[model samples]
Target chain A: MSGTFYGLGVGPGDPELITLKAWRIISHAPVIAYPAANGNESLARKIAAPFIPEDVTELAIPVPMRREREPAQEAYDEAAKLIARHLDDGKDVAFLCEGDPLFYGSFAYLLDRLAGKHPTVIVPGITSITACAAQIGRPLAARNDILKVLPGTLDAERLKQEITGADAVAIMKVGQHFEKIRGVLTELGLAERATIIEKATREDERITRLADVPAGERPYFSTILIYQGSEAW
Target chain B: MSGTFYGLGVGPGDPELITLKAWRIISHAPVIAYPAANGNESLARKIAAPFIPEDVTELAIPVPMRREREPAQEAYDEAAKLIARHLDDGKDVAFLCEGDPLFYGSFAYLLDRLAGKHPTVIVPGITSITACAAQIGRPLAARNDILKVLPGTLDAERLKQEITGADAVAIMKVGQHFEKIRGVLTELGLAERATIIEKATREDERITRLADVPAGERPYFSTILIYQGSEAW
Candidate 1:
């Protein structure tokens, strides 16, 4: 029988946010596949440490994030080859991701290459947007409202248009684009309604109103939630 | 010491989808609260069976879905009373929800009443829309695209406006509203691009093109995913 590959979501920062399905799969899988930088430990693997069996094999795929295209593609290809080797040996492998595997997740890149060649199961987890919204006691969207999830890297004009048209917006991938996003929000009169969350749901999580946040403190993993209408409560 | 209350999201379906945080709270909480009707088993409680310990207390709040306003509010008042009783006794309670607790979840009604009186934590989960989308190998929305989540119970005109403005839409709470929603989709020229999923990620899950789904086979848990733009792939 061909070995199965499990794409498990470990959830946003909180270790206890991993799904029970993912926990079971992690416990039973003979090998665990994790993404990391070269010679660095896997964040997903470390978060899932509580439930993993001590004897499970670890397969580390170092996926470096680079501005250039060739290096990233080459890394994914190499990782796929390595995962295939374990499948050839008939060892079930579970690749762990921080949130939902397909929602702006890196696992999608690997799944695109490895799907159909092997049986795969994706276990979804709590996305950070929802967690962040809940942490701040606000609903992402309410009845008859529109929600838009935008990557902060988009051009300012496009981001402004999307934000203006949306009843609620969750801005993700906010690294170097923080200032641009802040500018767009301010231009659209959404500065007062927006809230920024850095490392949400983690013990060290910070929740601050957009107006109060300093430009220098923004992190890439952080998200900004903007609600133009009534408060959720 | 004051006790806490948790509105935990179990997940779309599949018992294993309960998050680690929810699992840990469910396992350790002195009292477990779940919605039920006429003494029937609670679906949320059933999904969380794997992690719930034998010794924990169970509080079944019968939250019947009734059209009568007085009865529904009464149920909420009574449920709050029971939960408050536990809190007064210094016992933390975990109230389980099928998907994310804040997304059209009845737990919100309870939270509105008890949130200030007691310590509460809302743990988010994977909503059915994402689960349905992932199961069908479809992206919820491409980069910078507009996405809307609307209840199928909305008037057709309102639904049409939201659908027309969105690059992608997930129409949820779709049971008897099937024909109405279908009509609106057809009128908006979105019928061809829609996919319907019922009981997503569950054992009896069904996914099909909207045009092919037979009438009278729809369930309330079903969701319709409509992609207004060309396929990203």
Candidate 2:
């Protein structure tokens, strides 16, 4: 009598950006799991709070956003086993993903363990790239233009190459690596066209051009979108 | 007393996928516009139909989907002027885009004409890439994996080169270009890993592996996602 394990995408920073399917699941799922950062209230759970009931049992997987996820694999592994136990008890477990569960989400780590054994569904959410683009009133790419969505976690050399070949580029996870990514965009002569967004769709969201952004540490949830608008498509 | 112009992203196929912001705008906008194929009911309009009142003034922007849009620039220009007219008359116009209005969306064309003159806001929606990934329960990319979103409108040579350089690829508008993109994936030894999704999140949604898809005409809403999972990130 095991129940389905659902991975819900709550979307980027906005509570209302969650899809109807995700909202339905969040409201009804008896057992829910969300990744928390160093014992902090989970961002995914926060975005889904409007839909989640007070009675649902919650499991918080401690996933550090400031550090590499490989080091946190053991924590996720244990979380999966605990979640599987709940599934075995016939209680549908909704594991909230920050964005699209498959898009750089921590839920992928859990899906590897739970998806095969239990019924699983991944509800897609609005990505930071698009949300940032909307906030900036800039098109990501159009008319045969190729958009390369890269991670700022990449080495500077690889980041430079990826930017050079892209018509449009959106870099995610630009926490402390903003300076490195900014350098690549500069080398490729795209720094002026780049827009950095922090906590997109949130009330306190910030949008600034690369050239205007002050030198400092950015929040963990940020995206850098660079458009080569002059390129002939 | 000119009115505000908004670019609303209705989301990938699901009607309920529309965000609360978009829903709020769509319900109250004096005029709404959406890209239509010839004289048919617009797909964007259909996704947003739930919010649009029967008496709301509708503007159908005829944008050909079966052919390249370069040849249809005049149509978009005309549509933009018509929308601007509504805004000039103190009417808030909500132009519906299928996905994120700024993420490879047709709204960009209208924004170029409207945003400079009238107040504009772009509401982000769930991208087809993420929605397709959700439908398949696969993440688009994770960690440092670079996701290349290429248009099927590209030349075969360019498409092959792009695919080779990408850790993950999602090709948009795979209508008649399915075979061409399939060939490129086969050349890159990624045909087996490629998944084709038609009308993702729709009632009659179809999901098939690139290799297993029968030789036929794919829908204009189709997407082909190729993942290079063997690479060590």
User: Of the candidates shown, which would achieve the greatest DockQ relative to the real structure?
Assistant: 2
Count backbone clashes in candidate 2: 1
Q: What is the DockQ of candidate 1?
A: 0.40
Q: Which ten residues in a row have the lowest lDDT in candidate 2 chain A?
A: A64-73
Candidate 2, residues B69-184, lDDT tens digits: the string is: 46466777788889889988999998898988877776777787777889988878888999899899877888767899998988889988878867788999788888888888
Local distance difference test scores for all models: 0.79, 0.83
Where does candidate 1 chain A have its weakest 10-residue lDDT segment?
A65-74
Give the TM-score of chain A, superposed on the true chain A, for all candidates in the order listed.
Answer: 0.94, 0.93
Q: Which runs in model 2 stand beyond 4 Å of their true positions? A: A69-71, A216-219, A230-233, B69-71, B216-219, B230-233
lDDT of 2 by residue, A1-233 (tens): 88999988888888878876788888899998999888899888888888889998989888766455354667777888999999999999999988778987767778877888999887788888888888888778876678998888889998887788677888988988888888888887778888889999888898888888877856567899888854322
Best by TM-score: 2
- iRMS per model, in Å, is 3.4, 2.3
